[model samples]
Target: MSGGVVTRGRERRDQQNGQNSKTTEQKRDEEQVQLAEANSLALTMRSGLQAISKEIRDLKTEMKKDLTTLKEQVTEDVKSEINDLK
Candidate 1:
């Protein structure tokens, strides 16, 4: 009877260990999937940010060109007005 009990106890412990190993493996797989998704999202966001940065740069260039044109026009108008007053 004593030998039988010891064998049964070992069997139960082995079963529990197997179950724990399976659970750990499942958790590792889930973590890997989540990490992959997070990396993909980060890459997508970086691409969007790059596009936005380019658009902002283009807008700045256009605004500078417009300001330069306006300054030249204003200078010409002022010169014309002074000559007419004289």
Candidate 2:
């Protein structure tokens, strides 16, 4: 009877160990998937930021051109008004 009890206890312990190992494997797989998704999201965000930076640079260039044109127009108007006064 004692031998039978020992054998049963060992069997139960083996079963529990197997269950724990399976759980650990499942958790590892889930972590890997999450890591991959995070990496993909980071890459997508970087690309979007790069695109925004380019757009901002283009806008700056356009604004500079508009300001130069306005300055030239103002200077010509001022000169015209002075000549009329003279």
Candidate 3:
């Protein structure tokens, strides 16, 4: 009877340990899933920022071209006026 009692106690302790191990594994799995999601979000935001930055650079280049053309046109008009006055 004492041997049976000891066996039963050991079995219960082993089952309790198994449950704790499973719980720890579950928490670890959840943390890993969360980390993956966070990484995905960060990548998406970085891609969006890169696209917006490219667009801004393109607009700046276009504005500079427009300014250069305008300056040339104004200089031509002034030269014409001076030649007419002479």
Q: Per-prediction RMSD in angstroms?
A: 1.4, 1.4, 2.1
> Which tens-of-lDDT digit does each residue in 7-81 have in candidate 3?
999999999999999999999999999999999999999999999999999999999999999999999999999
**Per-candidate clash tally:** 0, 0, 0
lDDT by residue for model 1 (1-86), tens: 99999999999999999999999999999999999999999999999999999999999999999999999999999999999999
Clashes of 1: 0
- Error (Å) of candidate 3 at residue 37 is 0.4
lDDT of candidate 2 over 10-72, digit per residue (tens): 999999999999999999999999999999999999999999999999999999999999999
Error of 3 at 13 (Å): 1.6
Deviation of model 3 at 57, angstroms: 0.9
| Residue 64, model 2: Cα distance from true site in angstroms | 1.0
> Which pairs of residues clash in candidate 1, taking residues 3 or more apart in a chain or in different chains?
none
Q: lDDT of all predictions, in order shown?
A: 1.00, 0.99, 0.99
Global lDDT of model 1: 1.00
What are the runs in model 1 whose C-alpha is more than 4 Å off?
A: none
- Supply the TM-score for candidate 3: 0.77
Better of 1 and 3 by TM-score: 1
